[model samples]
Structures are given as structure tokens and as C-alpha cells.
Target: MNISQPGLFGNQWCDAPWRLVQETITGIQSLKSDVDFMLWTGDTVPHVDSGHLSTDLNKELVRNITELMKSTFPTMPIYATFGNHDYHPKHVFPPYNNEIYNATYLIWKSWINDTSQDANFLKGGYYTVLTASGIRIVAMNSNMYYVKDTATVNLEDPADQFAWLDSVLTNASTNNEKVILTGHVPPGFTTPRAVRWMTEAFNKKFIEIVLRHSSVIVAMHFGHEHHDSYRLFYNQEGTAVVSLFLAPSVTPWRFQLADGEIEPPHNPGARLVKYDRQTGKQLDIQQYYADLNKANADKKLIWSLGYNATDLYGIQDITPKSMGNLLDKMTSATNKDFKAYVNWYNTNANTSDKFPCDDACFKKMTCGVRHLDEDSFSKCLTAVSGSVSLLTFSVYSVFYAMLFVAIYKLFN
Candidate 1:
């Protein structure tokens, strides 16, 4: 579950109602029979407004969420990564030497429960845990390389953790153990409108290290886009190296692009990933979502599988090459495959139905496609706007202006 702070009782921009939080916890608790453990990729705080949310409040939110997880699955082990919004001052995450790290350390140390890991988590908010199945789980503080705010980041050692990762993978490989990596920001093109958060330079070195040990590193999991998506990376020989799964968010935060009008709210969702116990390769991924609108109307929580990896993308084993091929089909295919891509992206159940892919929404999904060429991106821009506009000229103008700015940023 990609958990975030309950969007309530604060000066936050958009938050999930308290009732939704309760419903989400109850829904997960009911699935304990099917789930063995939880992969909680971060964003523990709500999207706050301008004012400084007190440290006490921030820690309280983390504590509350931690307690909720413990209550939901008393014996389940949860591996989590911190999201960009999980820090103080919104996107600004202070380094380990600061009070922020100390505060966060106190909250997470008890949950993480390893003295060695506590030391590492304090230094860089990253650590590695060896599961009983001999699988290595690397929890990374990927926000360290985030581009939005660099000052709060300890530039002196920004990419040091990647070096740490290399060492971890080397040891895991030597021990004949399979590895799973978890982080908040994925390596590349998380969304088309903006470049990936981990600077290309860092991502390059990170991928190089990953390819060097791809045999042991079986799968990667991440959550930040708040949408169901996947990313692929290839080695120098153009062979598939790694694949990352982007988990859907639990918060029903209203969807907006800065000053743009809010689109339809995303349904709250989570995933259950199954793996080949012996090989550590992913067997399948099952995504489940609750219709927030329907839940609100009926005052009853309902959850169901949105889809599985194999049925949606047509791949038995998740590899970077397989995901890349799927992306090609999504960008070029004209019939059911294309429609499926768009509908699954929108989280719409019916492909024939008029799904919401407004100018702002459509570009985001297109841009997120891995290795998307400029010409194809331009075609996507045109196709989205081809539909007749019901919005006024003023709104249309603003949309175009934003689109122009987005294109400018994409190129420059």
C-alpha cells in the first residue's frame, strides 16, 4: 500500500477524508489471508499549504499511519520508502545532520527495527533487509536526488547511496540471493510533462550499477506518480536489465497540474504482487481499487481487482524488454491495444466508454511512455486536442499556454 497522510484537519491543499482512511484500512485488513507482507512506498504527509506544519504534527501523522498499519496487519512486515512530500517544508528534505532526519528517524526506527538499518536510515534514509526467503529488500531514500529543491539535499553526498547500492548488490550476488529494490521516484520519465526526478546523471550511474548486477536484482517497486505504471531500463547491449512497477496511491487527492483545473479524483488503490519464490522473479501483479465516488454514495467500501500484469500487458514474465515492447504497442497500435492502454491508464473499466483524457491529462500519460520520441509526442499532443472543446475559449487558451510551456520544458 502506497500510504499518505490522511488529507484532513489541516491547512493541506487536498486530503483524503477521514472516512476514506478508515475504509481503506478496513479493506486491507480484510485481505490479510491473501497477503504475506506489505510494500509501503512513502508519502506519509498530506499535500500541505504554505504555512509550516509543526514537527509535532508531522511526527503525529507518521505515528498515526504507523499505528494504523500495525493494527491492520499485526504480524506483517512492511518495507517502505519516503516520498518527496513525506518531508517537511513540502518538497524540501533536510539532510541527516539536521533535526528533520532526527525526528523522522525516531518515528521510523521503531518500525524498521534494525540497529544497523537505523544507522543507515539516519545517514541517508536508506537500508537493506534480508527476508526469511533469502531475498534482499533495499529501501532507498530516492528523494535525495530529487531536482525540485537541491539545497535541502546534502549535495556533498547526493549519489553516495548509489555507491552503497552497488556494494549491497555485490554482496547479495555473492551470496546467491535475489534482490528487490524499492524507492519513491522511479528512474526515468515518470510523467512526460516533466523530466524524471533523479537527475539523468545519477540515473545513468544507478542504471549502470543495476545492469552490472541484473542477474540478482530481480524486480523493482516504486510509488510516486499515484497512478498504475511501469518503467523499463536496458543495458549497453540493448538487453532488458530491470523493470519497475509504479503502485497506485491510497489517497484520493484531487488531480491537478499546478494552476490547472482539477481533473476527476483518482480512485484509492493498492496492489498485491506475486513472485516466483525460488527465482524471485515477478510472476504477476494484481491491482485492486475502490471507487471513491461509489463508496461515498453507498457509505460502504468496495474493492476489486483492476487488472493483472499478464492480462493487461500480455507478458508472462516482467522484463524491461517486455515492458518496452508493450510501450511500442501503446504508442503505435490503433485498435484494442491502444484503447486498452488509454483506458487502463485512466483507470477506466470500460474501454469503449468516454474516458477522461483532457488536454492536461492525456499529455501526462503520453509523456510517461518510456523512450517516447519527439515526433510521436507531438502526434499525441495533436490527437488529444482533436476532440471538440466544451470548455470556454479562455480555458482553452490557458490550456494551450500550459501545453506550450510543457513542450518547451520537455525539449529544453
Candidate 2:
């Protein structure tokens, strides 16, 4: 559909039209001089149903986005991942090589610039690219963790990605190189619903892998939820080890899901992460976004800073420790920190119909952020929410006690 004036988020139903994509690219190009490389945690295709799409159509869509990135940043490298929607059948990635993989390898070979890692990318849509000194970028096909990817979901080690990830991380640790992990879907539930992206078993496995290699990994980035939120990876001791940043999508489509869940509209957001090239330590994330409503109305896009991570959250840096502290602040719904959390965490819609961020929402989000395993997430809600219920009962008891004293005084 050709929609020019797509308003930024309360009830917009249109996908990112071509003009919108062009304008978004223009906004990104504004940072060409300062930015180094790009992390395109993928979903090049639109949110169209599987029945209407074909393998060729999906391939073209990937190619189109790739070419746009190439044209925008001619010299800069873009490490991309395979999104579930990039597949024709959508979320049915196989353990074995396929037609699209080979095609993608050819289309992306220039950007990857390393034919040495060709085999793995062809086999299971993943590869590693070493940047400057002491840094490596592992573009994993996390779509394997996706629950609807039935071909590999039941398999204990889909695409052998976990094993490969372990080996890669082990190698990075030994080489004294820090790795930046990039993928499509992250290991947490969606920002709103405790939606199932990956199955419980896969999520658990993914979390284990992160914990095992937490020391060697410097930063992680993913995109899929299209919601501006992040996940905290904690070790068995409940200490945060790694942080995964989920960048909001360029597409502002409040997607029509099968289950009829509707997310409030959000402006198109792109994050520019500042980091130490030597240590691979992320310094900050500069989130840039255009007011979809204003831009569309004005017939031009003006991207501005939505917020900076360290500054807004009052955290020292974008690390697991700081992120864990942020999560802790978010525990209380009435707190100002959580108020800001709801604003930015909901993609800054501030729409009238925007859903309320109640204590229940906070509980689900907290558990989702802390526990990557679905089972652990459920258990966390049970333990925490159960206590909340008990606290409610205690408050009722105190109220009744006060009431009885007042009644006795009145009788006297």
C-alpha cells in the first residue's frame, strides 16, 4: 500500500511504505560520517501473510534492502542476520542449506567480504566477521530459536548453531578477542505480552550459551519485537552477565498477528551505538527517530535524538550491571524511573489509547528480562506475583483492623 502520511503510533495499520523506507534511509545516511559499521538484525520483508508470498519474492525483498544499505553506506560494512519473515513460509527455517541461503550468500558476499566463512552461512544462515583489533561480530541465525520454525524447533540443536556459537565464543576467548553478537529475535518475551518466540527448551539453551561465553562477549544486539526494549542475561547466581539491545524497527507497522494482539504504533527508530573499537565496550546508544505524524504531515523526515541510553537511565554505561540496575528501578510501577521506562520502553508513543503499564506488566517484563528460559520466566512470575497477591491480602487485613477500631470508638 502507498501510504505517505502514516501517523507514528496509536492505531496505524500500514506497513512501512517505500517512501517511508527511503526517508528512513535518508535519516540514517545523516550519520554516515560518524558511524562505523551497521548491525541489521533482519526482517527485510513486510509483515505479509505466507500464502501471499513466494520464495522469489522474499529473495527480492532481501536483495532490495541489501542494495539500499550498500548504496547508503558504500564503504561501511553491514553485518546482517536472517529474520523469520525473510523466509517464504515464514518461520520455517531448516537445519540444512536451502536455495535462499545460497542466494543470500552471493548477494551478501560483498558486504561480508570473506568467502572463508561461506560454508556456515550457506549451511545455516550464520557467519562471523572480525572487525578491527580485539573484536569479532557473530551474525547468528537466531531464527532457529523461533518456535514456528517447525523444521528445526523440535531438534535439540537446531542448525548446530549453539554448538557453533560455543566454539566461536571459545575461540574468541582464547584469541583474546571480544565478540559482538547480533541476531533477529532476542531471548526474551515480547515487550507487551509474554509471547512465545522461541520454545522453552531453545530459550534455555540460548541463555546457557550466553552465560557460558559472557566473559568473551562485549555487546549483543537484536531486532524482531520492533519494540524499544532490552534483555538482561543473568548467570545462575542471579548476577547480570550480558545485555541484549533490541532496536525498534524502521517499519512502524503495528503488525496484525494471528492471535489478534495489537501493539501501539511507534515511530521509526534507529540506534547508533558508540563503543570503544579496541575493547569493544559499548559506550552509549544514540536512539534517533522521526515523529511519524509530524514528518508525514510536513512531507519530509527530520530525525532527531529520541534518547541516549546512559543519560536517560542514569546508568554509567551500556553494560549488564547498569542494565540490571535499570531493571531493578523498573520493579515498581509508580516510580519515575519506571514511568520513563514505560514511555521509551513502549517506543515513546504517548498515545491516548496506549496500554497502561500496570504492576502485572512490570512483573511479566521483569521476569522476561531476567530469565531467558521460558520455564524460568513462568516460575519467576509465579513466585513474584504470588507474593504480590499475599501482600494485597495483608493490606486488606490492616484496613479491616483499622475499620474495627473506628467502629468500636463510634459505639463507645
Candidate 3:
């Protein structure tokens, strides 16, 4: 979601390379022939200096991006949610942020369809849109679940969103309507390396909500990790409930690992997801990434498909059992090739072989696997650690605190 300060990268880590954003929009428009709609999971503002940005500036950024998307695909419906950087004085997105919510709501008015849901969107950037085919699309403001200072937050409102979600899903189930939920932050940690985005407590609750409604939920989507990845939510019996796709961003930013390792610059990426129009089941996700190096050389900009969900991950179907089984195998250390594929698909940096992914980099990709089946997954990680640097226990402790301090200061 980050496309800020076009042409400005400066020296900041993970700053979205804004110069390529226009090209990204062009690439997205080219997908109109294939995709039915777009799900933009938040963060239109730059992460760099986010806390210092005024509310007006943030609004302008959101407006500009929205206008561009509409112009690019005027006929296709585009739905969005709030990213942490979308709010000014960054990450302060309570339901009471009336002015901020009102301004942003108008930008997405036409695409949202249901006028009756505007009040809910205004109160908290969450709403439901029922399609002409009776499929329910629930958009959530998941930024509230991220690591933040709880003292400044509205304690009751965060829980209120979950209650509201319970009611929405219950109604959707009663009507026998298939549902697809979309949001910014995914419901689990980005990696078992450590909790990267949402608090552990909130993440568990979010997963429980998804599991309770898994029977009726067709699929779920998220953004914010910027890297291409997916989460397999499973029940106590190790059966997968749903596989949440975390669509990569159209902004190239650096990713830092827990071991003080800074990854090479990632190429900006986007996803073209196809779903069955009637049943609301996701068929596959086509990942497209822009090569910044080639674009800068006056070469024609190319947005190539990295891979499709089915071809890449080898899941037989969308059902929980099939996907959970696929994830269990992928996380196993014995499958070195799959680990390497994830490293490559995660970003454009892997394109030139300038910096090959090492053991530590590969571990971060598998860390999310534990969420799928902890008992067996722990055994897999233990075996994998024997061949990789799996950082010392003390280092993990310090890394967690260090990341919190770094992100808190950056977003403050």
C-alpha cells in the first residue's frame, strides 16, 4: 500500500520506491481483461516520516491513489481497508477518528455500493458489501490489532469490531451467503521468527473468528507485509480452516530480519486474483512484479507473473484439509527447493541473483508454518535449525524489543 514521495528513496529502510508507482498502476490496468475486481488492503501513505505527516497530507495521498485506481479501471470495483500509515500521527486509528474516516470514506463511496453501510465505515473503517450474486464481502480495519501503545487506544472499540464481525458473519451464515473477508494486517505473525505485526492476543482472536465462520467464508485476503506470502489457519485437529493470501505490494522496500540482517531491495509487486463469480471461491492468485532496474535503464517496463497459487504451492483444492496438508509439507526443512521458491517470489531482488537467500532468510519464510500445526511444525523447525543459524534464544528476546522500539519511533 505504500507509494509515497515519488522518486525519493533517500537512505531509509523499507521506504516504498514511489517513482515506480505510476508504472504499477499501468500494470494493474492491464489486468482488467482478467480480474473481476480489486481488493486493496490499505497503506497508501509512506512509512517513512509517517508520524510527522499532517492529517491533510495523508488525506491527499489517499485521494490521489484512489483517483488513479478509478481512472485505471473505471468499470471494476475496488475495495480498500486502512493501513497503519494511512492515519496521520500514524497508527492512531480509533473509531472516533471522525474527520479522517469521513474524508477517506468519500474517496471510496461509489465502489462500496451499499449506502446504508456508510455510517459503520465512518465509525470504524469496516463495512460489508453484498454483491448482486449474493456474495458478502467484508472489509475490516485491522490496523488496530498491530503492535501499538494501548494506553492511547480506545480499549472498548477494538473488541467492539470483533463483536460486530461475529454478528456480520452470523447473519451471512443464516442467509447461506458465501463470504470473503479482506483487511490490511493478516491474522497471524508474519513469521515465527517473532511477532511482526499484530499483537499475539488479537491475532489469536482474529483466527478464532475466522475458524468459527470458516464453513461460510469462501476466502480471505490481506496486504501490509509487502512480501508475497500466505497463512494457513487450522483447527485443533490440524485441519486447515482457510488460507489467507497476503498480496505483495507495488512498492519496493527493504525487509529486515530478526538477526539484524537487512534484505536486498525488493522489487515492487501486485496480485491479480481470480475467483468464481457465482460461488465466490478463489481460483488462483497471479503475482506481478516490476523490475525497477530494467525500468531505469530505459527498457520497456515488464510486469511478469511470478507464479499462480495452485502451480506454486501445489494445493489440490481450497478446502481446509488440502491446504493445511500442503502447508505442512512446504514448511518441512527437507524441502529445500520450496523454501528457495518462496525467497524468490517474495521480492524482485531474487531476479538477478545479486544476493542469494541464505539459511536465516529461508527460516523466516518457514516460521509462519508453526501456526498451521505446532506439534509437527515445531519438529520441522527443530530439524531445520540444525542446518541454519536459527538465532540464539537471547538474541530473539533482544530482537523482539528492538523491532518494537524501532517501529514505534518510526511511526510515532
Candidate 4:
């Protein structure tokens, strides 16, 4: 999940002669995996003011990022969705125009349409990619549903998008392919009240549609809320239609808490998700962070929340059986405790001089961050494995020490 708020930096930030392309290349190379496909969850350029609708510089930035991505991941298929920032011209401008939209789309098209590389880009910011495992990955154009006012935009209740989604879900169901939905804005969070209201409404409609084809709609991945979150939206029949997973932003800006505190603050990272086609299960979901503590750390590079190294903090196995159970628990006590832990960290954890939140408090508290019950169980499993490894090392150390002592005594 590559959801970086690049546009938040503004024109100056985007124009600044930065080696972000190189840093990005390094970050992707560190992952060390042949990914099936890469999802770019929008917001690629700096957010431009409404008046600067025709900013050529912003266009160049978008073009640069797209080109850079192509060079970095030559063989991987790249898909993109627009964020509010990317769709500013459509929303902020008085007249609903498609000039900026067309330009931005053209930029993506240039890279995606290029057949020279092993990349396949989709049109309309929404399209389906049939993976080798027979799973259908749907990337939605979330910008169509956003209605931005001077204050904020509504995200949750996207009626038009919901209609489009309904059609997509219906088609996926008929085809009998497992579905993974990717977009910019997620379906939860009530802040930015208008967006929340829309999202809630959208969720209701989305849940209804998902319930109709519950088994087909497996996971919904998104990035907007710059924190890792998972919520399962179920239908009245107790069928789990969608499991919402929000990816943290790979940018410096962290979510502002109620007390004006930010926890696990201002790090850049991305998620590596592996799905099992046979069982429609998420085999592995890990978050990776760019290391910022090195002697010559690039100040421009940021780490995502929960990012430790060039990857996520933990190795979570969400295989079919585990994922089903995990989703159930995640929406219950498990998720609540996770949120509580974050609140505590924001209020109590000190991140002033640190890179990512790597204090003991964070390590001890991470297990409780989300989906408490499942994470707790996961933590127990991790502890047991850790203990076994430690014990094995200790036994060897003791045996070596005893042998050395015996040899010394014999020599004496």
C-alpha cells in the first residue's frame, strides 16, 4: 500500500531539488520480494491551491513520480487512485472541470500505457487486475465521490462511488473471483464531519452490497488516515462483507490527536500484503519503514507509523482460517484496545529526538494497538517463539562455558 501524501509539501517542496526518486528506489529495493503488483494510493504531488489549477510544476512533479516509479519497479504492474489532493481542481475550483483531471490522467496513462516495460496501468482510476491466483484486484477512483468545500471534504458517504462499487461487486460475484478493493479514502473515521457522514452512508450501502456477495469481497485496502487500522463491516446476516484495512501514509505528517499529540509520529513506510488465492486469505501483512537513524539519514525521507526498518514491525500471518477469525476479533475488543494503546502512546510516549517510536513503551504497547484479542494472541505466539530461540542460545552458551572451564582446570 503506497499511500504517500506527497502533495502536502506544496509547490516549493515538490520543486525542491530532492533525490526522492533515489530514496524511493532504495526503499523498494530493500523489500527483497517479487511482488505481484504495486498499488499507488494517490496523492502523488504537492497540494496546490484552487487558483493554481494549471500549475505546470505540479504536473511535472506527478510526471516525475510516475516515471520514477516505472524505472524503480520495471517489472511490476502499477495501479493508481486519486486522492483529494490529486483531485483538487475538480473539487476546489468553482466549475467542475476535467482539464486538470485529464492532464493528471494523461500523466498516469503515459507510464501505464507504455508497453515497453512490464507495467500495466488502468484507466478511470478504477480497474481490475486478474492475478495469477484467479483473484480480482479492483482499484477504485475515490476522487469521484469527494465533495470538497472550503472547510473539508466528505469521504465516508460517497453515493456515486457506491453505485459504481455496487456494479463492480456484482460483476466480481458473478465471475466467482475473490476481490480486493483499493482506494484513497477509507470507509470509517467521523472527523472532518462531512467526509465522515458521507463515508458512513457509503459504508451502509457498501456493506449492503458486500453482504449480497460476502464471500467474494475479502479485503478492502486503503490509505488516507496515516495510521494502521482494520475494521470489519458485517451485514445483518452476520456475513462479513468487507474487512477494511487502512495503510499509514508514507510521509512526514502524522495524524493530529485530540490532545494535539501525535503518536508513532512522522515516519514514512509502506505495507507489504500477500494474499492466498486458494482460500481468499491474507497470507502476510507487514508494514516496512525506511531507516532514518543511519549516520547519513536523508532528512527528506520519512517513516510510516509502526515502521521499524525498511519494512513493517511484525510478521503477521493472516492465512484464510486465521484471517476470518482475526477479522471477527479485530472489530471487537481487539480493535478497541489497539486504539487505546495509541491514545496512551500519543499522550505519554516521547518522540522528540527519536526516529520512529522505538522506545520500550512502544514495544510493550504495540501488541495492544489494534484488534486487541487477536494481537494479544499473536503476541503470545511471538513471545513463545522468542523464548524458545533465546533458550536455545542460552543452552549453547552454557555448554561452551562449561567446556572451557573444564579444559582450563585440566590444563592447570
Candidate 5:
């Protein structure tokens, strides 16, 4: 739910009470008939003061939502995991002095007992639920291993997590049960940067384990990216090991990027995933975006379920020409550069006409120019040098004039 924001006490649009009641009801109603189990992909509580009321409020909200669901679907089960924001970093140790953690755990335990009939539930954020169709859903807490030391948060993929995961996957595979794994973080970095770099060794190991039982592992659903997206990863065994499904944020946090694209206060939404029990195949997955203008909008009753694979498609190949080629194909015409192509592509690709590039000319050169020809590459360097020389001389002339004025003033 991307539960963030401090105003959870009131039932206003911007407050927790309103969002909770609205989203919970909306989610329940959306999947009332088709879904066998309702799985929450983490971030259940908004990260606020690590106190009893703060934690209790979140728990109460969940409890209320669970009761609401039960009233309709008499015996349906709801499962959840812990997000990094749910508990303070220091709560996971021998020195665990945090009252909030204890309180939160107690609240969760009570809720589980009250709401679910599942026997395999554990205290920590890891559990397995068997569906009526015999499909197993394994939910794990990826947030427990992270530690904040000084300025940086160290996210060491816990060895215990891997061991537990391995056992679960092995059991699922051996039992011939189709498994759907859930977590908060995506496997690797979608954005190429330092801070976002995840544990490569752990990611590879996890993927390898999943691949080993690829035949039974259908999909891995997660959140935290706050974007509706998906990626297909193939393993060495020639099996499409896992289909990563990221549900969109329930709150409006970020915006869609391409030009003319809808900016902030984006359409908040969630996903409805449908799986075929017989084939272990995902039949149809729909993304439902909220319509703000409607009454009880947060209830998501006035929303639309668009059938697009955007929630599952990973980062596109942004390599210039490939992007340009896509643009050309779409319009059945050639563009001079990547920017122009992207601009054109964005306009024609979706209902929103947004251009991703600002400098079409530069993108064109970067996309079209190759270093294969030594002479051409050298000539391009010379031209760049000439431009630099002209700019350098212009700057020098201004500096010289300033220096002369300063010298004259000093002499006078």
C-alpha cells in the first residue's frame, strides 16, 4: 500500500483513516469473487513514531479490513509481510529495546488469530499458505536484514533468509506445488546508481534457487519501487524461471516520466492477478487506477481496470537506435535522432503525448555515430576541439578585460 504519510488518524483524503477504509474496501470488493487469497505485498504501516498507538493504529486498520473481507468471503485468508518501514532498524537484535516492535508483533499475532485459520503462521515475517487449488504462497520478510549504521543503510542479504527460502522452495518443488513468492524489493537495480545497488551475490543465489524449481515457481510479486511493472528472468535450465510482478503504489508518490505524461498526483492503483490452477499459468492480470473525481474515490469503486502488460514489462532497451527503431516502426518513418524519435514515439505510443528527450540532435549523433571509422571519429573529435577552442577564447577575452580594469583601478 506504500503506507507513508502522517495523517492516519483522520478520515480525510490526506489522512490514514480515509485511505485505509477506502483502499481496503476497494481491494476487497475488487477481488471478492475470483481471488482465493488476498496477499498484501508489505508496507502495511506508515513509517512514523515507533510507538504503541502508531503501530496499533495500523494493526487496527488491518484488523478492520480483514473483518470487512470476512463478512463477504466467509473463509478467505489474508496474508502479509513486513516492510523496512514497518519497524525501527534496531528492533531485530539481542538488545531489542524497542517497545514498538513488541507492540506491533503482538498486534499482528492477535489479528492473525482473529482473521485467519492458517496453522503454519510464524511470528517473523515469513509464512506459507496453501490455496484451495493446492497452490502455495510463500511470503517472506526481506526487510529484517537491513541495518542503518551512521549515514548508510546496510542491506546485507541474510544467510538465514536464504536458508529458509531454500527449504521452502525445495519443499514446494518436491511436493509438486506451484509457488508464488512475495517480497518488497525487486531482485536487481532498475535504476543505474550507487545507492540502489542490491546484493548481487544474494540476488544470483535466490534466482538460482528459484530456477532450480522453475517448473513450480510461477511468479514473484513485490512492491517498494512504487511502479506497476514486470520482468521475465530465464534460468540456465531453459525455463522462464520467474515473472516479477510489481504492483503500483496505493498512494500517489511518484509520477510517470515520458513528455506530456501525467505528472504528480498520479492515478493511485493496485493489481488484480488471475492464475490458472490447472496450467500454473497467469491467465489475466489487470491494473485498476483510481478515479479521483468519483464519490468515495478511495474506495476505488469508480476505477478502471485496463488490461496492459505495463505492470510486468521491465525497463525498456533505451539504447538509442533500438529506441529510434521502435519509433520508426511505430510511425513507419525515420527520425534524425533519438530525441525526435522518442518524442514521436511517446506522442503516438500512448494516450499521453509526452516526449522523453530534450536534445534530439545530440541523441541523433550518439545513436547514429559509430567509432568503427577512425577517420570519421578523429574528425568528430577535431570538430569538438574547435568548438571548445572558440569557447575558451571567448572566456579568455572576458577575463583579460576584467584583469585590465582591475589593474587600472589599482594604479589610479
Candidate 6:
């Protein structure tokens, strides 16, 4: 967990230095040795202009990462999905197998250890593996549903993934097997802005499928947000049924939004999850991170525990009901618990002063988690957006009224 004068893990506010990746893998090995598998949600390539990248470059990037991963943990199973940037053009994934998918499947096929997954992965960049423990891992190509993706914008069920997903979940249920769903792009809205990640139609369908099969889904894990967050999915009955965990990026790069404002930078982070192999349930999550500033100053990269889900948040378990209660508690962005969530949102990045997270931000995030459906999300915001209590509002009204009277009297 220590680097030399060798201490600098690269720019804290920009793309990660290569050594950081190595350190992250090493850190994980040291921190948690019992890891059975890895769910890698894509974006193996660095974020750069298209002119600076191409099909060949994309394949190269994926190959390099895949090689490193294979060599590092030769025996462990690793499942991956494509991000918007994983392709040559960066945001267009056609339903058919193209050059990028072909090369990617070849590079990553061995990781699955199941030749049965080849057709799906090569066809539309998705596949599922039935693990030895009877737990099915569904690696979804969510990039096809991304807003920036143009290839399948007009097509319904572009890759027929929804149909495939429903069938998979149904089969898993029939076999009395649980599933761990992994994808790159998540459904629902973004945390930075209350924007949907997928098109309304696609997002709606995705949410519908999950809610339909909520009982069989052990957990849904996604990346691409580049921030640590979680979404709690609800059943048709409006009960919290599942939880989606979004792990922070290994890169500490701070991205600027379309509004041209640079996001608050966070330290590079990873998580060690304790789960049930038999039930495929995520029991706990231990977030670990390296302070970029501290590492550079101390002349060593040190990965330390950021927070424990059950310990810091006081959630009994990582179940959706427990997490739903936690979400309710964090609705007010100003609470101590919510403040800690903000801190870890960027892996302890100090944005509390320069980039203040007000009540509106909290509402958007919590609502997004509460309701994956777009309509419900918007309604949730409307129903629960007052940062000030009713009593406080009344007090302010009274004070303003008295001040207005005094000012009027003085003026008259």
C-alpha cells in the first residue's frame, strides 16, 4: 500500500497514472485475499478525443487490461461489460457483432471459462455464466442503451437483451438459482444531474424487467458513474426489492459536465464486498481508497479503509430494505451521515466548500435510487424537496413580515 518517491499516483484531478492501476490490483490482493470473482464494468480505454483513438487503439487498450487481469488473477473468474467509450466511435454500439466486439470477445472469452457464453458475447457484447456455485452472472451490454449511443436509438430491444434478460431470470428462477447482474451503464438518472442514463423507453423497459424478476436478482452491480453510489430498486408494490452497487473508478479523473464545470476530484477507490456464495447476496461492502494528496506528501501510496457499510451507516445488512431505510435517512444532505456519504462519494474528496452539496443534490440522488422509473423519480423530487422544515419556514415568514412592517413604517 506504499509507493516510493514513487509516491505520486498521478494527477489527482485528471486521468489515473498507469501505476495506480497496478497499485489498485495489488492493494486489492493485500486487502482482501479471498475474492472469488471480479465484476469489471468496462471503459478500459482512457477518456480522450476520438481523433486520438481508433478501432485498433480500442482493441489494444482492452487487450492490455485483459492481459494484466488474466495474469494477475489467473484462476479467478472475471466478468466484464462494455461502456460507451469501449468502442471505436465511443458511443455507438450496434446490436450486431462488429469489429470491436469480435476482438473483445477473443480477448476476454477465457475469463468466463464457459464456451456457451461465446455466441452472446460475440453477437451483441453480452453473455451469462452459470458459476459452479449455481449462481448465474449476467454480464449485460448496457452501452447499447446509453443516451449517446446512436446505433440503436430507434430500434426496440436493440439486442433483444430485455427479452434475453427476462428469459435468463425466469430460467434462473425455475432452477431455484440466484443471479448477480453486472453492467456498465446503469438505468435511472445520474447523480450530478437528474438526467436519465438511457433513453426514456430503454430505461423504462430495463426497470420493468428488473422489477419483474426482483426476487431472483441477488444484486446488480454497475460502473460508468465514476463515483461511488448505490440504487435501490422497488417492486411493483413499491417495496425495496433489490440493490445496485456502483463502484468508484480506479482513475481519479474528474470529468467536466456539459455545463463546463469540472466535477469535484476524488481519490482513487475500490471496494471489497463480502457476499454469500450460496445465495449470491452481498452482505457487506468495505470501501477502500488512497488519498492522492497524502500519498504524494508521504512519499508512498497507502490504501486505507474509507468506510464500512454496516458500521458507518448503521445499516443492518446490504439488503434493499436496510439500504432503503438508509436512503431515507440521507434525504437531507446536511446530516452527519449524508455528509459522510458525500465525503465517500468521491472517495474522500474535499468538495464540501468549493462545490457545496445542497439539499437539492441529496433529493435528486435519493429519488433516483428510490424510483428507477423516470416518472416516479420526477414525482419523488416534487414530493420531498424542502430542505427547510415547516417550522423554520414559518419562523422566516414571521421575521420577514415584522421586518417589512418596520421598514414600511420607517419609510412612511
lDDT against the true structure, each candidate: 0.60, 0.73, 0.63, 0.45, 0.43, 0.74
Best by lDDT: 6
Model 1 C-alpha lDDT per residue in residues 1-412, reported as the tens digit of each score: 2334322211012455555555666776675364545677877666554264656566666667767767776766677677777676666665555565666677666556778876677777788987656568898888876766465343635636877898999999889999888888667665534445666566565667777888888788887776666666556565556777777777655456676844443566776777765667676676677765555456576877788767877876456666666655553324355556555554553322334555464355544554323333344445544331200001110000000000001111
* Candidate 2, 130-158: lDDT as tens digits: 86444699999999878888898679987
Task: Estimate TM-scores for all models.
Answer: 0.79, 0.89, 0.82, 0.63, 0.59, 0.89
* Clash number for candidate 6: 2
Candidate 6, 1-412: lDDT as tens digits: 1223333566544455556666676667677555667778877776666787889877877776677677887777778788787787888888997999899888788877789877888888989998666678898999999988899889898878888899999999999999888888899887747778899999998988998899999788888877888888877676789898888887776676768767677777777766676677767788888888777677678889888889989988788888877876774778877787777887887544334678777777677777778787777777734532210001110000000000001111
**Per-residue lDDT of 1-412 in model 3, one digit per residue for the tens?**
2424223321224444333555567766675463446677887877656546788888887887788778877887777788887887787677554788999888898989889988788888888998655668898988887766252243644736889898999999899888888888676655534355666566666777888888888777778776666677666675667777777666555566557865455666776665666666656566676666556455456778776656766765444565555555654444744564565445545454344445554565555643533333344456546543221101110000000001111322
lDDT of 5 by residue, 25-130 (tens): 4554654354555566655444333553344454554455445545754554555555554544322321122444344445344334433423223334555667
Clashing pairs in 1: 7-15, 192-367
Cα lDDT for residue 8, candidate 5: 30
Backbone clash tally (model 2): 1
Q: Is candidate 4 or candidate 6 better by lDDT?
A: 6
TM-score of 1: 0.79
- Please give the lDDT score at residue 143 for candidate 2: 91
Candidate 6, 248: how far from true, in Å? Answer: 0.7
Deviation (Å) of 320 in candidate 3:
3.7
- Residues 1-412, candidate 4: write the lDDT tens digits: 1333333221111221234334644565556455666667766543335465445644555666667667776766666666655554534321233445456666565434434221112223455566555667677655554334322234343224455567767887787778877777555432211124123344445446656666777677776655445555545554334566666554434444456643354334466665654645665555554433321233455533343211221224443334335433323223543344243222222345332322233333333222112323244235642432111001110000000000001111
